[model samples]
Target: MAELTLLQAINKALEQQMEKDKSVVVFGEDAGFEGGVFRVTAGLQKKFGEDRVFDTPIAEAAIVGNAIGMAINGLKPVAEIQFSGFMFPGYNQIVTHAARMRNRSRGKYGVPMVVRMPYGGGLRALEHHSESLETLFAHIPGLKLVIPSTPYDAKGLMIAAIQDPDPVIFMEPKRIYRAFKQEVPDQEYKVEIGKARVVKKGEGMTVVAWGAMMRETQKALKRLEKENIDVELIDLRTIAPLDYDTVLESVKKTGRLLVVSEQVKSLGIASELITRANEEAFLYLEAPPMRVTGHDITVPLPKGEHHHMVDEKRIAHTIKKLANYEV
Candidate 1:
């Protein structure tokens, strides 16, 4: 095992996949020469050569559209949309073409492509550089959604997404790219899609969250423990086809739930999880499922993000209310 940053792990995964599969190709804005705006793809173009890894024009629509064509033609294309917000330019192609192609052709055609984007906030980034839109893609049918919270998950899930036989939207918690280092196997390895990781276990309320929010959750858990709250924290690594069993089981044991995230509360992933708990684990609840999420408004400028974003205080407040107050 070797310690690697989230960015390093992703680079290793792409490097290994390119070596293992001749059909695997990577392309996107700055993906070739500059290694991407975040340097996630740095040195890949030089190592893999221009043919297998090359740069493309600054066009999300063109990038995604061509990836769909490549997948249909039997090539595994890993395309990058500079950021989560830029993905909308390619939304129609993803939903109507890449997503529906396999079902429309009745299995005659498919796009085994991975659309990667650096997502989430707390990076002090400008507009369009920070957005958590996993819920939007998860709501659409025919697309697989994977969000990696750690270096290990980032590397393993990227490999799996590349090899999946359908379109996949891979969201990375940009804020945690270098947050810490962890031992990630150097050899080939993969984590299955739609699976959640139980990061920490306890018997009190279950704090369910994913991506960048996982960091804040960890901090909040520490604070709660000081108050004698033994919270079980669940890192929901995947959003769509959620690991409902893992989360529901935790909810059952704790008899309370708090879903946290940095996305807007309106029609967000937190809302979906709350609905799921209601439908599947309503009776087991000691308190109504609560969500500590960003407000339903445009992401604020740097100075005001802290006010709108979820933090340790917000999480502790929810935990206290659920543990001490009436449902």
Candidate 2:
């Protein structure tokens, strides 16, 4: 086992996958020699050589389009998009071809490709560089969406995404890329897709989060510890095929729900989770579920970025509200 940061975990996952599978090739905007914008692919090109791990032009469409073609012909292509917000140029390819290939071909072929993009807002990045668009890809069927909040889950989930037969949008929360570290196995492992991890068990209320928000939520949990608010925390690692069973069970036990995300509240993952809780566990609730999320507007620039983030103060306050709610 080794202690690694989220950034290092992702890079390790790619290295292990490429060495294990000859057909696995990685490329994106400055993904090769430059090792990506955050150095997530730093040593990959040197270790695997330019053929298997290389860079691409500034063309997002070309990168994804070529990945689809390669996957169809027996190559496992791991494509990178510098930022999730910038994936729009390649969105058409993903939605039209990569996502629908298996179904379009009637199960005759599968797009075993992973599109890696750093997503979400926390650090004071440029406006275009900050966006939590999980709903965009999760809304589409036949495409898997993964967001890991910890280094252990990052490696496990990335490896699972690489090995998956269908297309996957692996969104890395850039905010926590180097924010922390965790001890993870050096050998290969997979945290099955569509599963949620319970960070802690509690009886007061259920709180769900993923990616960078997990860290902030955890801090809030600690602050509320003295408040005697027994809260259960869930890390929703996969967004699309959400592990609703885990969420529902927790909500059932806690009888209260609070979902936190940095993305805008409208039409977001929190809405979906609350809706499901209403549908499947309405009677179990003691109070209406709550959400602490980003404002609905274009992500603010670095100057005003803090206003849009869900921090410990916001999360702790929301949890207290849910804890004290009645009726």
Candidate 3:
């Protein structure tokens, strides 16, 4: 095992995958020479050379579209969209081409590619730099969405995403890039894409979240422990095909649910989880699951965004309701 930061783990995974598979090619704005704005792809350009690890023009459409072309031609391309918000320009390509390629061709063609983007709030970052748009991607049939909350998961999930036969949108929580250190396996290991990880176990309530909101969920758990609330924290590492079995087991044991996420409340990933619970574990629930998420509004700037985002106060309130429910 080796101790590494979240960003460092991502870098190591990309390096390892590139070394192992010659089909894997990397490209993005500044990814080649500058090592990317976050330096997640740092030093790869020199190691892999310009042809395999080079930069493209400042165009998201070209970047993603070209990746689709390369994938059809039997090359595994890893394209980085500088920011979550900046990915809109290439959304059409993702939804139309990359996603539908396999189905449209009836397995004759496959876009085994990874689209990496930094997402979520709580970095005091520039406007539009942190949007939790995982729900939108999950709604699309052909795309797989992944969110890594820690250094270990980041490395493993990245490897898995790269190797997935389908296209994957790999969302990284930017806030925890350097938050803490974790021991990642020195050799290759892949975290399954559609899996959930139980970060903490408890019997009182199950607190579900992904990406940066996960940090807030952990803080809420610590605060609730003072009140004798043994909360279970489920890091939903993947959104598209959520790990419903884990969620079902946790909710069935706790009989309560509090979902936290950086995305807005309207039609977000939490809503999907709540709907799934109603369909599968409605009888086991002591109280109706509640979502504590960003307000259904535009992503705010730094000064006022904190007010709009969900935090421990909202999570605690939800848990209290569950604990004190009469019905």
Q: Which residue pairs come into collision in candidate 3?
A: none
Task: Assess candidate 3 and give its TM-score to the true structure.
Answer: 0.97
Ranking by TM-score: 2, 1, 3
Best by TM-score: 2
TM value for model 2: 0.99
Worst 10 residues of 3 by lDDT: 217-226
Q: Compared with the true structure, what per-residue lDDT tens digits does model 1 show for residues 1-327?
A: 899999899999999999999999999998999999888888888988999888999899999999999988889999999898889989989988887888889999989999999898887889877778888899888999998888999999999999999899998888998999999998998899989988988898888989888888888777776688878889888887789999999998998899998998889888888888999999999888899988988888888888787888898788888777565
Q: Listing every candidate in turn, what is its Cα RMSD in Å to the true structure after a full C-alpha superposition?
A: 1.1, 0.8, 1.2
Task: Mark the 10 consecutive residues where model 1 has the least summed lDDT.
Answer: 318-327
Against the reference, the lDDT scores of all candidates come to 0.89, 0.94, 0.88
lDDT of 1 at 324: 76
Show how many residue pairs clash in every candidate, following the order shown: 0, 0, 0
The number of the candidate with the highest lDDT is 2
lDDT of 2 by residue, 1-327 (tens): 999999999999999999999999999999999999899999999999999989898999999999999999999999999999899989999999888989988999899999999998877787688899999999999999999999999999999999999899999999899998899899999999999999999898999999999999999988887899998999999997899999999999999999999999799999999999999999999999999999898888888888887899999999998898988
